[model samples]
Target: MDVTQSTAGDVIEVRPMTIHIGAELFGVDLAGSLTDEQVAAIRRALLRWKVVFFRDQALDHEAHVRLARHFGAPTPAHIVFGTNESHPEVYSIAKHRTAQNGRTSATRCWSGWHTDITAAINPPWASILRGVTVPPYGGDTQWTNLALAFARLSTPMQRFVEGLRAVHRFDAPAGDGDYARRVGARDLAAEHPLVTMHPETGEKVLYVSPGFVKEIVGLEPSESRALLENLWEHAVSTEFTVRFRWAPGSVAFWDNRATAHLAPVDIFATDFERQFYRVTLNGEVPVGVDGRPSTLLSGEPIEAQPA
Candidate 1:
């Protein structure tokens, strides 16, 4: 359904892309300061829709950080990927730059479905990704509502997952001995619930991230793999997902707590250039259905100062 709300005499258009997961929000400018009412409305839409897209936004590094501050504290760019030099909070997802630098290795961490930085004790609460340059075709990003995915599971399946936990790790790139050693020293691994409760909306989220999640805690490796495979297959079903074709000046803001997103694989097959900038918001430690919080297995949390 299309929702248009008039707040402070400004019409903010919220056009739902699907019954669940994604929406296109119009009428708000991210390059400038936002009013309290506008921020609140946007946050409400984010919680309800899981992810929101904005078209034709003009946001530089400073403006991107400033806009993200309205919702939550902006964390550093990434633990592994690092951030933009001048703007410490802005992480560039520059494909051309990485390709030029020969950083693309056998490890395909960023190419799979994941919630940002699950290896940390406190994963990001939300993420805002703005497209700087986009390809003409076949570089669409996709998101799935984990809450909805969990809701559709059988009652017995829900009960089993609620009591289970899994370890998430940032796999280091292959063939880089020194870099791999550094990553191994940091040991970016954390155990989080297979099912976690959303801190804001209080909805149950299927917290298995196929990219970072390694194995289920307290289970045999085979059993863990099998269970995780089933969960991953179910979580990414087409009905629970929404795909967004990106363009320059497009921005996607999503709640990291209740969603997992797939980065474009088709982009690598083409010679087209694609680049984007992302800023993540600080998130609390995930709490399971039994009211227990996730435990840090190795790495420190990616903490962010107050916005």
Candidate 2:
């Protein structure tokens, strides 16, 4: 697709990647402090596009966290992973060198599409990820706009889901070794509406995804499984999705409340390495259309302090 750039009063140049869901912003240095107007412009683009990309940004761990604070408080790097001791809010997403050396043959283990930390009572409001060691080819991530996904469903289907709630839990892949063990220790879980009103934009989001949502509340096991399967399929349909190819120095900022993202499955097929660092903004409890908040099933809310 041809990227179309437009300037809005010298705030920033927005190069929309598609008719919906994704855009690339130009003329901002993520490494430096942002003026109030710059911050507001970035936030407005994020809410409208669901995800925005920046190319050739020179962002270190501290700069990454600093940029996040302009929009909201930064959450702990991750619930189960170790972060840099000095920069506790910067989470690394790199493959271990030891694991790389040991693997002569590879098996695909997809993380599946998910919003950031939905198992928490307050899932992250936004996430900023910067590419570090990008592969020469492949390892492209994709995101689906849940608000648009919900809007495209039949009227009756939308109404039926609006009243529903689902259970979300951080399910670590079994036999994944250390990472799995830590996630097992945490065992975070929550019950959230299948559809929630975006806290800032007031749009309804179809909140279920294969990564975290476990089952629909108050349904028979078989019935819940079948229903969830159907919803997951529709929520990630191509019409509501946008794919991004990553390069070193590229960064993506996304609204976690209104989107679910797929990690690069093709990376497993290549010997080339991929790595990234991310900081997530603390989120408010999601409210359903009926005006109810999500219920915590297990674990405490993620701890975060302003950056």
Candidate 3:
């Protein structure tokens, strides 16, 4: 399908990167000022593509924050990580600094498939990441369209999951070892419906991820494990994904409500450093298609902290 749109007489060309998930936008420089019409068109492209990419336009911290503010309010740096000293809104996802005492932190690689901060009562609406330093090879990230993943399920399976809710926690599940210790050690946990309705587009999205979702609520231990494993597998099927290779100055902006992403671990194997600055837009509490809103099992609501 043709997804490109033009606004304010400045044609915005949106080139689809894959059948289901991503698009590369041309004719707009993120480092410069954007017209209101251009911003609207970019929002439209985001709804259509799930994630949008930009290449070659170098952006500093200020430029990055400006770019994000054009679309939505930027939240404070991530709840867990430290933010840039000057730009408090931007989270630094650098490989070297994430480690402790010379040993890599469990969160360092972050190679698993997952959504951003689902353990919070309100996850971020979107995430804008700009590559500050990219490796020469093997640090590509991937995103999957959760709406598409939901649509591909059989009628009965869809119905089954629609009524289900799952618990997402920061603690690691059994057998995760150091990785779990790193991620799950945080004091965060929440319950959200398995099928969430996009607040803006009203589309049904498969919301479970192996990274945060620990178990299906109200199910037997064995049943929950088996079912979650199956859902996780289906949600990340290759047919529903798009992969993007990063380079210095490259940017990826995605709707966190409708997608899940995988961070690359291959970059850690080499001496090359991979660094990015991320800014997230505060999101509302998710509502399921069944009309029930997500419930907080442990943590407090995610409040908007002015950038």
How accurate locally, in lDDT, is each candidate? 0.84, 0.84, 0.82
TM-scores for every predicted model: 0.92, 0.91, 0.90
Residue 97 local lDDT, model 3: 53
RMSD (CA, Å), each prediction: 2.9, 3.8, 3.7
lDDT of 2 by residue, 29-91 (tens): 989989987888888889989999999999998888889988889988887665654788988
> On a 0 to 100 scale, what is the lDDT of residue 217 in model 3?
91
- Model 1's alpha-carbon lDDT is 0.84
Look at candidate 2 and tell me the lDDT of residue 129: 96
How does residue 21 of candidate 1 score in lDDT?
Answer: 78
Among all candidates shown, the one with the greatest lDDT: 1
Candidate 1 least-lDDT 10 residues: 99-108
In model 2, how large is the Cα lDDT of residue 298? 95
Candidate 1 at residue 156, lDDT? Answer: 95
Residue pairs in collision within model 3: 170-184, 171-184
